[model samples]
Target: MSPVLRAPLGRVMRWHRPLMLMVASMLLLVVVSVAGLAFDDRVLLGAPVWLKPFKFAVSMAVYGTTLAWMLSLPHRGRRWTSGLATVFAVAGFVDTAIVAIQAARGTFSHFNKSTASAERVMQVIFGNGVLCIMLANLALAIILAVQRVHADRAMSRAIHTGLGLAVLGMALGFLIPAQGTAQTALTTGGERVLLSSGHSVGVPDGGPGLPLTQWSTTGGDLRIPHFVGLHGLQFMLIAALLLAALAARHPLLRDDRLRARLIGVAATSYTGLIALLIWQALRAQPLIRPDALTLAAAALLAALTTLAAVAVLKAGRVSDGNPPAAQQANLDGGRVG
Candidate 1:
């Protein structure tokens, strides 16, 4: 059987991954969203006319697929989880609908408290939709935490850590909206222009950025870590799964407990790195800047990650052939940026 199936659900053995509806809907949105690119229409911010629709479409795909995968790790057959999954799927559609409609209307999707009744109504719809999606995620986290799903011990622990970190990342996102609604300014050809809510503290929003990511090469951008932390669960869990898979072929990772320990270390260090990124952004340091302090902090995080790898190697010393369990695989092939 498949490697994962080999480690069937222990106490919660009957569970399955209910990803069909969510996946199909997200794929449909993605397909429909592409047509927006062909239109010659309004630009809300500095991005293309279709940018919001495209971005939201992609976001829904990633969210649906990633959450589907994570949720699969827990109990599957229960009626409530299935219902919740369906509700979350609908929430994704609602999210995409609001963003797309706003884009088509040639207005901003966020931070634009327009006084017109129609505009206000649309904004309210968008805001309420976002809140619902966020709460759904929170509810998912709580369920996964309280209910245990049987898997390899190391894999299980890794999943828990990754999921928890993903939640933390989502929480950090609140900082963006909570900040003042001041528009960022950029200077070009001796003229000052305004940019979207990329939230630059030390430099302008529109600067030399890394292509599509638009993370400032010349300023501080909290979105970087916020993005990174948001994907924490997927990244860490992927590592655990890879290591678990490798154990079948490599003697070094045979002790699942050691793998679990390594995942824990990785998770702790990962959260630290996320915090460091946020701290750097708050300091208004450019993402691509080579300032000594930023370099040092980045170096430290790298070192810790490397050390964790070494620990994973030595972790096999116990050789109990078992331990705890883990999360994150390219997350059903989700993409960021």
Candidate 2:
């Protein structure tokens, strides 16, 4: 292939590549999320939108894959690893099925229109689904961290800390209720009778909102929190790439310019992506409009691309050093003279 075609093809592959299936899955989830927002009025469920439940289901799948991959890493026991992987997979499958069913029945907005009994049930089910996915992801991260402690202590520490923060953020989200005042007013005998109890149960005030406390808005949906929580995957994956970069610095791989280059690209791309996510979150000002978020995302992407170029160039210069094989052979032969 010509270099021009090759380059564009490579970029396409990178975007769609399952090089990290979990990350790829999350990207898909993000797309779904954007679509949900765009078509909020379509009513996939009785809820006011179609995308939220789908987003959650996608999250479960992404996290499930992460959990499974983490467990399969070397040094972890086969049995426990398999069991945990199974748990995550099963939970993800269940959540996906639930969301699909609700979506089919046009009940995605069901929360907005459910009666008291139906509303309670939906809340309980949704809450449990969230917990299942979060805990599964946390468990996988912990396992990876523990395994790395003895072999790659620095990497382990970084991953552990990042994962801990992610878990904390996700847990905080659970504490916030999804209820809205409008929903509550509709429920209690009030003038804003958007839907009767027979039609929809409406989310009560202080019900579960988004998962992250900082992202919640007075009348906004949980997209911001969902975005924040899911972005943890980016952090963990970047940490993994950074660890790989650090590993490449060891005499074992440093002389191999190609390996270093690959790691460099992976790390730089992920780091840029992380910055973009942060920018997106910041722009999603609950106090402001969504246009700010769009502009911030664009600007951050441009800036990140420039920075990544510089970082990759620097990483490629590691070949000007001692090779691992020569050093090892010299040590083994012990010909000091």
Q: Residues 1-337, candidate 1: write the lDDT tens digits.
A: 6768667433223332344555666677666666766654444335554665676677666766766665555475456666666666776677677777666666556655545687678667766776666666666666666655547766677667767777677677667665424573322122233323445667544456666566777777877777788788778768888888889998767766677778888888888888898888888787777579888988988897888778667556644444333223353345442
The numbered model that scores best in TM-score is 1
lDDT of 2 by residue, 117-155 (tens): 764576567657667757865775666656553234433
What would you estimate as the lDDT of candidate 2?
0.48
Task: Quote the positional error of residue 7 for candidate 1 in Å.
Answer: 20
- The CA root-mean-square deviation of candidate 2, after full C-alpha superposition on the true structure, stands at 10.5
Candidate 2, superposed: residue stretches over 4 Å from native: 1-41, 44-48, 108-113, 116-119, 149-162, 178-226, 242-337
RMSD per model, one decimal = 11.0, 10.5
**Could you estimate the TM-score for every candidate?**
0.77, 0.49
Separate clash counts for every candidate:
17, 22
